[model samples]
Target: MVAVRRGDVVVANLDPTIGVEIKKTRPVIVVSNDSINQLSQLVVVVPLTKNIAHLSPSHALIPKGVARLTFASKAVTEQIKAVDKRRLVKRLGILPPALLTQVERALKNTLAFP
Candidate 1:
């Protein structure tokens, strides 16, 4: 059981989804704080996707290889979700400071943070 911390990109099981929810097993960014991650059974995450053609404030562009992602992807901030920690397969890598900062900004925008 490795430590899953905020800013870490990890693979997760997001199957059994319905409607427009992001489906299948995929890489997701750990957005929840470290304290909550340690105290709670669920881990908050944002799914990544290669669909970056149409950009919006709801999506954060993430460069390839930044977090062990082989392809350039978009962080679907609007699709933020919380899944059981057991659903996390393995850690890919951690987002660097600059990228993580951008993610926070995008997340705030998606959440209408002041």
Candidate 2:
């Protein structure tokens, strides 16, 4: 199985999406626990978008150069989902600890954790 871990940015084929869902192939952040990634064929992910109009409590601002990306990105914590390992195309790079923490914080707010 592909080795995915929390905070890793991966290129995934998110096609076959339903209406209003993030579509096409894109970068996504792996959010599942390491143990979960190791033991299951699925991993949880949060999609990143270049269409960042503004930052919100539910979005983590990712600077350009992050994960070798040419453009700055934003993590849409609200769009988190799980997909089969087969959907992961490649690992772009892993988010640094500080940025990863920021994403996690936004994710926490999205999940309504205190």
Candidate 2 stretches greater than 4 Å from native: none
Error at 35, model 2, angstroms: 0.2
Q: Give the runs in model 1 whose Cα sits over 4 Å from its true position.
A: none
For 20-94, candidate 1 gives per-residue lDDT tens digits of 999888999999999998999998999999888998877888998887899999999988999998888899999
Indicate the TM-score of model 2: 0.96
Q: How close is each model in CA RMSD to the real structure?
A: 1.0, 0.9
TM-score of 1: 0.95
TM-score of each: 0.95, 0.96
In the range 1-114, model 2's lDDT, one tens digit per residue, is 468888899999999999899988999999999999999999999999998788899999999899987789999999999999999999999999999999999999999998
Q: Pick the candidate with the highest lDDT.
A: 2
The lDDT per prediction is 0.90, 0.92
Per-residue lDDT, model 2, residue 27, is 93
